[model samples]
Target: MSKKVAVLVAGSWGTALASVLAANELDVVMWTRSEEQATEINTQHTNTRYLPGAELSPRIRATSDMEAAVADAAAVLIVAPSSAMRAVTHQFKPFYTPDMLIIHATKGFETESLKRMSTVISEELECEEGQIVVLSGPSHAEEVVKRCPTTVVVASLDKTSAEAVQGLFMNAYFRVYTNRDMLGVELAGAFKNIIALGAGMSDGLQFGDNAKAALLTRGLAEITRIGVEMGANPLTFSGLAGIGDLVVTATSQHSRNWRAGSMLGQGQKLDDVLQSMGMVVEGIRTTQAAYFISQKYGVQMPIADQLYHVLFQNRQPRDAVEALMGRDPKTEMEVMKLETWEQWHS
Candidate 1:
């Protein structure tokens, strides 16, 4: 018999990942707050609201009850949005054990706390932060559910934990790599959304390929700048979590961040764009966090700054573009290195 693997919240990504685990022949149980949705998954075998045309594996199941979902699971994967990370993790805590492997696939920081998702999970679970493994990379949930050739990196300070997760998720169509740079992987995954939003804005503005290309290049520099400032290895930014995730999110039509930015560029209000998206636009919240993070850390994030103004201050997207294009002159290469970041700075 396959061990049960519990996934929290059957959103698109969560549902997609549940499918992957089911394909691997694990008894996948997904936790959802919606009883109707659970019934739909159990009976119809489709999540039409999210992945419209995709057929889910029979091994996948859904429930509205949280404890019931994790009761007999050998491993638990949390895929809640960043906004609900704390609350959802708090709910998952009573069932947590040091022996059960815990992994999170959420991308983005806690806007209220400016902490990474892993940090929030650890604090709630009362486990060493290193015990948590973060799964991230260029893989899109849409593609992964299709059993498409998808690759991702799993990072943890615990080598054994990383390798264990690598084994659990790896298969022919789904390739997994292990990275020891936990901080870099998480930061790269979250920060790239800001850039992807900007890329979509550039495209929405009809700024042409040259403009989008420049945005991606400089956006990476800024992401690496802050990632290193937060004690991440600079080399990690060159890997899948960094450059690879950045490229895919910034360019793909599947990216909500890109779609949100495109709507903003098309002159729609942020509130309306979000309502239209009808799903979580991570970059919007992430941009809010990044703006403050850059300020708190004393690092310069020109692109993020402009986006903040555009997003919150009602600065026009074109004006944001102009502000970026009209920055002060300096040496083209300014390095970001934390001379030993004491601890994950609050």
Candidate 2:
């Protein structure tokens, strides 16, 4: 029999990834909270709410029972929303085996604890931090399901674990790269959502391409600065998980963070915008966590600062833009201090 893989949750990203695993000829069992969704995938092979018109593979099956979904599986992929990651992992703990390849594709931090998804999962699963692999990058589920050629990176402190995940998900349409800098990969993936939200807000406010370009560039510097402070490799920010994910999330119509930001920029209240989207806007919650993270690490994240004000403090989006533009002048490469630059090059 072929190796079986379990995907927790049937969200768009999860479903899309399950399709990839099924395409790679692995038997995929997805665990969902909704029995309706499980039946839809098993019967109709459609998840209209998430994937819309895309038809899932016959090899992909879903169940509401966590034990059934993970029983005898070779690997289990946790794709629950960051907010629900802890609960979802706890639910699967009874069924998880140490030898199973554990991987997660969720992006965002625990708002209260400000823990990355991997940290939260490792704590709940009682596994070594290095054993958990994080898969992230610029890939969008809509495109990935349609086989539009998506590239993503999987990172783990253990090279063998990362490579195992890469092998499990790699195929013609979906490409996976392995990175050992798991901290950098997870940080870049989570932080980029904040910038993407800002980008969408800029466009919604009619700031045009130039403003968006500046935001992307400066936003990246802010990300790199804070990431380095938190002990991530600076170069990781320039790779697939950083700049690559940033561009896609900031610009793509499929991006929930960008859409939420656009709505906010158009003068819609946060509550109303979220109600209309009906999806977990990871960036909004991430912005909250990033704000506290910046403070904890004593890093200057001007863009995130302004965004927090706009988002929570009810500062007008236009006024926030003006505030960002009107900050006291400083050198462009301030984020890369002289000492840090030399150390990086050396």
Best by lDDT: 2
Q: The CA-based lDDT of model 1 is what?
A: 0.91
The C-alpha RMSD in Å for every predicted model, in order, reads: 2.8, 1.1
Off by over 4 Å in 1: 338-346
Sliding window of 10 residues with minimal summed lDDT for model 1: 337-346
Kindly list the per-residue Cα lDDT of model 1 for residues 234-306, writing each as its tens digit.
8788899999999999998999999999999999999999999999989988999999999999999999999
What is candidate 2's lDDT per residue for 1-346, written digit by digit as tens? 3399999989999999999999999999999989999999999999999999999999999999999999999899999999999999999999888989999998899999999999999999999899999999999999999998999999999999999999999988888999999999999999999999999999999899999999999999999999988888899899999999999999989999999999998999999999999889999999999999999999999999999999999899999999999999989878755666577679
lDDT of each: 0.91, 0.94
